[model samples]
Target: MRPQHRVSARIYSVSLRCAASLALALLVSLGCSDEARPKAGAYCKISEEGQASACLAPAQHAYPAFFRGLAQDKLSDEQAREVETDIAQGAQSERSYEALSTLAYGYYRLARAASSQGTADPETLARLEHWNELLSKAYASSEKDPRYREALRQAAVDVGSRTPPLGLRCTDADGKPARCDSTEAVVRAMDEARDQTGVRGEIGRLFDRVFGTRP
Candidate 1:
């Protein structure tokens, strides 16, 4: 149970902070069409204009709603799990800057919840580690885009934690062990294996760089 493995499209949700609400609105505004939402597999596939955005719009809207539900205690554990799974799948399926940032912030909230629980069982520790990995991926994915990165960072900051400690161990170029003690250091390490040639390669490269070949 390594933390960095991508969860099956089977887990996550979000909050109603001003920033999250604004982000949800912005993503919604990206489309003018009222087309149906995409299923788990189709959400991120680029389509002609309005089609893709339309498909993703529901997921965007759902993130905040799910958050509000959780915060208000209106959602049961099973309901929360289902929404989280949709969110996790939606974020990965889209791989858009906004989607990834949303995922990062969602995980940040989950981590905060886990922290407030005041106990660390195996499940809790695993969740905390996974939360760290997701946050790192979100940051690494958005590295070249300061606007996106900063937006996500502020969202996490608004959650009251300055940065996520990813618990990554690094190595210098020569293969000697290195230390990534801060969020910046972890992201920089992820940047090491980033393939600037293509957008889709970022996550894969990040896994290679930080977690070795296995991810």
Candidate 2:
């Protein structure tokens, strides 16, 4: 072969080898990359300041969009590690509350006794407290949000370790006495409220939730 042609061939061969090595390296890297595996999952789809749900995200370092309880339980080591990473590095002050809530739920699932269906640790209560604080802020920002009120009620129920009591006060919007038709006064109040307020009986319902009613 000519001198220049031989040099050119050598250079071409070296370039081809480098490209092959890089591609192989990438393949190996991907093979080891647990964070990107669909076999595992993570939660990263978020829209609001304090809302979250699962979504099948594009191939990103962020967690998966959503998964069922069985899927969550089947999370791979990489998935768990990514969640741990999010709890550590990703949870800035801005996302701290949401991150904590997510972590708490994960722990709750892991720690709960299958027979009893209760979490092992009480510290989950602290994490839930932080979550509720975020929710309260959101609700305060938008009091008219029926979802926010429902969320508040759910949080209260979850943290209090009991179902929310029936709102117990008995009076009409005009502050007049309303007689109960049944022994269960809460249901009776709800019926009366529906009768008075039409579809938007939330006003009386709010009073019941705030003050609680007896049966």
Candidate 3:
């Protein structure tokens, strides 16, 4: 039998942190709402505005809430860092993939958020690598067990992976024309790819010129 080849057709775009978002308030939308408190849920399955209360799965709940805060612009950069720190300390069932995956992701996202702010310390780098290790474990575990794939897919990429077809946009000083080119805007495009597809690692290195690794 011949060796099989792996091909992915997914096109990804690169994006940077919104330049003008420093003053943007947390955009909490309460419109199109649902308030059904699930009987035994940990996440907000209602998918409403304002903010998600919790996650259905205990392991998944923490990140959603934190990310929801981020999406809503509710959490300030400083506040978000606090949340990320707390998330890194999360715990689920003992020796459970879900728990470890969550922990690893929590640390990685913290790295991403902090990185955006031009803040990167030894602790932050350690946390990011730690998640990568956990993610690797989850990936290995997925070989024998398929259920763990989702866990790996979601949390693993943020640690430092490269997402392909990075769609990047570069704005000129005049702001006359915002150029969106995947080929020309390699740095920004790769960042967008990471944002969209959870790809990380090389993306950071490739964009180190534009994004800069440490503060």
TM-score on alpha carbons, each prediction: 0.35, 0.26, 0.32
Give lDDT tens digits, candidate 1, residues 1-215. Answer: 54543342223223336668898887777543332232222212223231223444554565656455435423334434544343344233344344543344444445445445554345534543444455456555554443334333433333323323443344445667654322443344444535455753665555456536334
Return the top candidate by lDDT: 1
Runs of candidate 1 exceeding 4 Å displacement: 1-60, 64-92, 95-98, 134-186, 195-215
Worst 10 residues of 2 by lDDT: 159-168
lDDT-superior candidate, 2 or 3: 2
What C-alpha lDDT values do all the predictions have? 0.43, 0.38, 0.36
> How displaced is residue 205 in candidate 2, in Å?
3.7
Estimate the TM-score for candidate 1: 0.35
Best by TM-score: 1
Worst 10 residues of 3 by lDDT: 6-15
Which residue segments of model 2 deviate by more than 4 Å?
Answer: 1-126, 162-215
Error of 2 at 215 (Å): 6.5
Give per-residue CA lDDT, model 2, range 119-186, as digits (tens). Answer: 32333333333333443343334233333233333333332232222222234445575432111232
lDDT of 3 by residue, 53-162 (tens): 24424545534554554444233445344334433333222324434434433443454455465645545444444434334443443332222333334333322242
Cα deviation of 83 in candidate 1 (Å)?
7.9
Q: Order of candidates by TM-score, top first? A: 1, 3, 2
lDDT of 1: 0.43
lDDT of 3: 0.36
